[model samples]
Target: MSEIVYGNLLYPQDDTPDETVLGCIRGARDVGVTTFDTADIYGMFRSENLLGRALAGEPREELVLCTKVGMPTAGGPNGRGLSRKHILESVDGSLRRLRVDHIDVYTAHRYDPETPIEEVMWTFAELVRSGKVLYMGMSEWPVESITEASRLAQELHVPLVCHMPRYSMLWRVPESEVFKTCDDLGIGQITYFTLEQGVLTGKYLPGVDWPAGSRGTDLKGGRGPLMRHWLDADDALTRIQRLAPLAEDSGLSLAQLAVAWVLQHPSVAGAVIGASRPEQLHHNAEASGRPLEADLMSRIDQILGGDLIVHSA
Candidate 1:
C-alpha cells in the first residue's frame, strides 16, 4: 500500500511563483510517490493548474492522479453542490486544468445536502462508464450517507474505492463508525491532515508567539483559525510535548509517528500530507513502510486519552 500521498490543498498560492510547487511535485515523484491528490476548490483552481504544469512530462501510466469536485468553483447559487449539472460541468473543468484524459480516482469533496444521493451516484456512474474516471469516492461523509451512496453505486455497478477523511492521532472520527461502514462496504480510507496542519510537527510550541513562517502566522485564506482547537487545548499540547521522547525512542520524528499511527488501522490505505517545499516530501515519505509495535501503539492511545474528540468539526 502507498502509505503517504502528496496533497495539493496547500499548494503555492496563485500569486506565488510556480517554481516551488513544481519542485515539490517533482520531488515527490522522484522519491517514488505514485499517487497524488488534489481538488478543484484547492487554491480556488490554482492547485490543479500548477500540478498540471508540474506533471507535464511524467509518464501518465506510472502516476495515479486523484482529484475531487462538489465545491464552489465560482460565485452564485449554481457554483457548487453535487447536482448533475454541476458535476458534469466540474469534471470537464478539473480534467482540463489537470491536463489528464482520465482521473484515476475522482471524489466528491463532500456530501451535498441540497442534492439527492441518487443523482450524485448516477452522475459518478456516468463518469466511470464514459472512461473519464476510473473510480469514485467521497470525502468527510457520514456513515449513513456513505451507506446510501454505496448502495446506489452497487446498483449502478460503479466502484467506490475509497473515502477521504481527516484522520490523525489528533482526530479519530472515522474509527467511531465511518471505518466500520467502509469496511463492511469494502471501501478504503485515504486520510488527510495526518499531521494536523503541522501541529504534530512539534514546531508550534505552546504559549509561543505564532512562529515565523508557520501556518498559524498566515491567517490569510482563513487557515489560521482552523488551528485554534489544537493551539488552545493546553492539555493536548502538553501531551504532545511528552510524546516527543517516545517518538525519538522509536527512531521516528513526531510527524512520521503521527502518520504511521494513522496507517496502523486496517481501513486506511493512505495518508495525505501537503508539501510546500521539496524537502518536506522526504520526511513524509519515510513515514511509509514503517511498523509501529503494539506496546508503542498502546502507549500512544493512553497518552492521547480514551475520550479524545472523535471529530474536529
Candidate 2:
C-alpha cells in the first residue's frame, strides 16, 4: 500500500453493547489496526463512549484517531448542520466523547449548505489553533461544496486535508470527479462502503437463503433494490456472481477482492471496513498488501457494466 496503513475503520452506531463494541476495537488493534474512524453522531454518541473506553489505556501516539461533526447530535433545529455553533460545540463534544485530547483529522460529516464556508473553515482553524483539533476536512460532500470549502479555507489560510466519501464497485459516484479533485487538491480520500454493506462478500448467491444477519437480508432500511418495490430481492445478485472468477484468480476472498479493487484507485486514502467480529477484521487486514493483477482488475470492470458513475466537480 501507500506508506499509510488502513486502520481507520467505521464503527456503526447501532445498539451494539459496550462489550461487543470494545471487543471489536481491541480486536482490531490486537490484529494491527492502528487507526479508527468514528463520528459524534454515531450510535447517538453511544459508539463513541464505547470506543473511548476501548482506547482508554492505549498508547495514543501509536494511533491516528479521527471523528466527525456537522450532523445532529440530539436531533433539533440547532442540533444539526454546519453552523459555527454546531461545529464548535460538537468538535469539543467529539473530543470529550472520544476521550481524546485532540482529534487527528476532524471532518465535517457532511456538508451544511446553510452555513457559510468561511465560518465553517475558520471554526476548524480555530480548533486547530486552540490545539483541540489537528486538521479538518469534509465527508460525503458534493464536489462543488467541497471546492468552495477548500477555496475558502485556503483563502483564510486554514488547512483542509481530507475528503471522506463512499466508493466501491457498487457505488462508484466518487470515481467521476471527487477522486480527481482529491488528487488535484492534495486532499486525502477516505472511502466507506468498500464492501457495499457486505454485498460483495460473495456469500449472497442467487436462490440461497439469507444468512442470519447479513446486511442484504436483515439490515433494516438497507440501501438495496427490493424485488417487491423495485425488481426482485435478488437484484444485482447475478452481476456480483460474475465477479467471482476474478476474485479467485487473485487468490482473495470476495470481500478482500472488493476492498483491494478500491485500493487500486490512487486517490483513496483509506477504505473503512466495518467489523462485527475479530475474524472478519483479520480477513480485511490481509487485503491491505494483496495486489490485483491488471487483467483481473479489467475483468471486474467488465462485469460491473453500465455507464460510468459521474459526479459534478
Best by TM-score: 1
**Per-residue lDDT of 173 in model 1:** 73
Model 2 lDDT per residue over 1-313, tens place: 1212333233343444568667878887877777788887677677677778888989988778878887767668689888888887787777888888998888898888788877888787888888898778689888888888888778766678888887777677877788788778788887876776777787777777767766555444343552222114354676777787777777888888888888877788677887777678878767886767888877777777663322332
lDDT (Cα, tens digit) per residue for candidate 1, span 48-98: 998899998888988889999988887786789899999999999989999
Off by over 4 Å in 2: 1-13, 219-235, 307-313
lDDT of 2 at 224: 51
